[model samples]
Target: MKKLIILILVQVLFTLGFFSISNAQAPKKKQILLIGTFHFNNPGADAVKTDDFDVTTIAAQQELEKITNQIKKFNPNKIFVEWEYYDQKNLDSLYQLYIHNQYESYVEKNFKNKGNYDMYVQNEIFQLAFRAAKKTGLKQVNGMDYPLPMPFDTVMNAIHAAKQDDVMAEISAYTSGMAKEANLKRKTMGLTALIVDLNTEKARKINSGFYIKTLNRAGQTDNFGGAFSVAEWYKRNLYMYSIVQKQIQSSDQRAVILLGSGHVAIIKKFIEDEGLYEVVELKDIMKIK
Candidate 1:
């Protein structure tokens, strides 16, 4: 009887151990969406001149309708955007302020007349986004800093490093040529198509070494301050990643991140560097021709 009992006990332990190992090796499931965008509020002629103005005017009601529909499909519990900390807390106040005037007035009061405010008003991306969030009952979180002018010296250093063997100059020339070509095309074609073509090589050559060098030479002192500001920009963005990670992990639903094309690359970089969260690209949903 004792021998029989020992054999049965050993069998049970082996089965339990096998099952535990299998469960431990199973893949973890995640729900994350990263959507890249053109700055709807950007009123500058950059897009216009570069043939990159797709959807020049963001149709507020139509845009909101699309966003809300996407939300319904994804059912994300959290929504993250490129906004300031204070704005996140008082969305209602922002909504009120945004609706009071067109994009031009908002730009005059807040943006220092840097971007094309008239274009932003016609586009109405910000207002529409705000409205969508309110109507959908989604929680909003800030994702990035304002597009303040960068320091020149630090930028020069990065450029110098990049230019070690004339690499920066060559790349800059290539991108500038492409941007110029796109700009020429914009005069005849629809803005959306031109914008897409321009985007095809945005990161590769758009600003590249030229912008870096310009920033380096802008200031009186080191100019390094703005030059090195990219790191600071990354740090701020990473903080948003940390916050979103915490928020999403605790929730039962998924999360969606809405940001500019520039941010798309960085956010993906952060997720990979952290090795904590799994991120899905929006391109997976849309058919990008």
Candidate 2:
């Protein structure tokens, strides 16, 4: 009876040890660093433009290096950029050439003109995302942009249907004025300061404030322009978040996303809700002094 009892106890211990080992080997939570930035080239394509800011200057390039160093401290295993989803193959091919030290010359030869510089070729994708990936030995950067058609017409039609054209005009005037003032401030403050400011909770709230204000304009009705506006924006961000989710592999325990400042609040909210990732604040990591 003593020997039989000893054998049973050994089996119990083995079972407990096996389960413990399995639990210990479970996949760890992913760490995501979301870096919200202004388009370095000032493409003039966004809803609000910041005037034309040249990033190719010596001073701007030095500031960019500082920013990149701060990002590097995060030690991201993967990088995601705001390129269109359909362009993933092209982005990957570019990244391959980038890692091989052939991308810069290729870009210069193909994209440069005497007076025209293509933001598509030399913007944050190359300055920050590509640089960080190459430094960290990441083979590729994922593109998370969904490029959905904007629902401007839908919103406008709704406004007309509701006879709220005046309301929309007022909202547009107020938002555009505020955006213009902010852009002027950014122009005065310079790049690093603008980037640091934009990544803060305060900046995020400011952006969210504009969104919510517009949303509220839809009134309590179901088919208001505000409702359509809110839905469209939310839908785009949700799709982008889903794409970002797909890029996460078991091996990618750390990832960084580089995107426009406007999208940061929504994306960060999505990530927080997901509970699978810990969002590392750029302000904390960069700690600009």
lDDT of each: 0.53, 0.78
Q: Which ten residues in a row have the lowest lDDT in candidate 1?
A: 45-54
Best by lDDT: 2
Top candidate (TM-score): 2
Model 1 per-residue lDDT at 40: 50
**In order, what is each prediction's RMSD in angstroms?**
7.4, 5.7
How would you encode candidate 2's per-residue C-alpha lDDT over 30-91 as one tens digit per residue? Answer: 89988898887666767665566667778777877876776677778888888987788999
Question: Distance (Å) between predicted and true CA of 132, model 2?
Answer: 1.2
Runs in model 1 deviating more than 4 A are 1-28, 45-68, 95-128, 131-135, 139-149, 153-168, 178-230, 246-249, 287-289
What is the number of backbone collisions in each predicted candidate, taken in the order shown? 17, 0
Candidate 1: tens digits of C-alpha lDDT, residues 154-252:
555655754433534544565577567655765665433432443344552443334344433333353344445655555656766666666565544
